[model samples]
Target: MAPPRNSAVKSARPVLAPLSIGNATPSNGGTPFRKPILTKAQRKAAPASGGIRRYQKSTELLIPKESFKRVVTSTVSDASKAHPMRIGKEALESLQEAAENRLVKTFEAAQLLAIHAKRQEIQQEDMKMIRRYQKSTELLIPAAPFERVVRELAQDLMSDILFTKDALKAIHVEAEDVLVKIFEKAQAFAIHAKRVTITDKDIQLAVKEILQ
Candidate 1:
């Protein structure tokens, strides 16, 4: 019995070459090769620092969050004493933000006032000026409060006086004008003394001059 020569022929098996670190390539051509990730210590050793380092906050804000929160709580508590209402967290936060903005603007206004007046330092007198604050609303005493104060003062001089609401309003308006004038005069005295804050003596002198 004879066998076919083609049946005895064997297929050649391909041999894989040993992989060298320098010349080794990935099995899949479609997938790109990626570099090994470094640890924190290795990251610091890298030429470009922080290549694999975790991110962290660099610094804190100028005003502490807890302190600001406490301030808001105190303000809310004080307001609640008079109004007797509960303030939500959102409302309290809004109030805190508004207060911060107002204070920042106030300091900026003082800086501008000082620059305009050619002064190196901002004074209490600078804050006293309505123009410096750029406040649209006028600061005025209420007629009722003004009437009550006037009635109390009258006890030392004359009594049995009744004031109409209109009369009391007029008096309040006039008194506000006079008070502003007196304050300005006191500020002038402070300026003359080269003082930033107006002293009691300066106020007394201003009042005396106004009465005279």
Candidate 2:
């Protein structure tokens, strides 16, 4: 008598052994993944976002991120006050992005300037050409007149102290920086007012808001 078909089929099937936790392996032959080991420099330079990475051979950053952000906020605030207009979130973000791009390009141009001067370290003078610009022909103040005004202001503040050549040059540079920023803000005022020409009031308001 032959065994029942069901009993024969069961006998022919292979019996599997139970897997132990220590000896269990994945179905595929690949090894288990582990975290990557980072070098000291990599660890130090890691960004908080972990999004995009920019690597520089030198440890120095072209501009401090926080300082750049502060400048952008201040610029936006000044523009708002000059125009009595509000900026949306998207516009604010766009301004920040544009500012960042400008900063990078400015630094790159400054680096080229430094290289042309055969300097490994970029100095303030190397960045002068990158920063130098005239917003309006009519607003251009003659260098001599600007220097004289700075001298007068210094004398008034310091009880007529003698100014050295370097001191005078530094004062002029600082004054130019201040005036340029004010003029740029005033241009926004003119545009907001829908006028082609910037009036004295625009300049005054710009200076007042910036000072405040």
**Number of the top TM-score candidate:** 1
Scanning candidate 2 in windows of ten residues, the lowest lDDT window is 50-59
Q: What C-alpha lDDT, on a 0 to 100 scale, does residue 14 get in candidate 1?
A: 59
The alpha-carbon deviation from the true structure for residue 146 of candidate 2, after best TM-score superposition, in angstroms, is 3.3
Candidate 1 local Cα displacement, residue 51, angstroms: 57
lDDT (Cα, tens digit) per residue for candidate 1, span 26-66? 55333344578889977654553253122113332335667
What residue runs in model 2 are displaced by over 4 Å at the alpha carbon? 1-143, 153-159
Relative to the unseen true structure, what is the C-alpha lDDT of residue 104 in candidate 1, on a scale of 0 to 100? Answer: 61
Model 1: runs farther than 4 Å from truth? 1-139
Ten-residue stretch with the least lDDT total in model 1: 51-60
* Residue-level lDDT tens digits of model 2 in 23-70: 443444444444689999787656444332334344444556567567
Steric overlap count per candidate: 0, 0
Could you give the C-alpha RMSD of every candidate to the true structure, in order shown? Answer: 22.8, 20.2
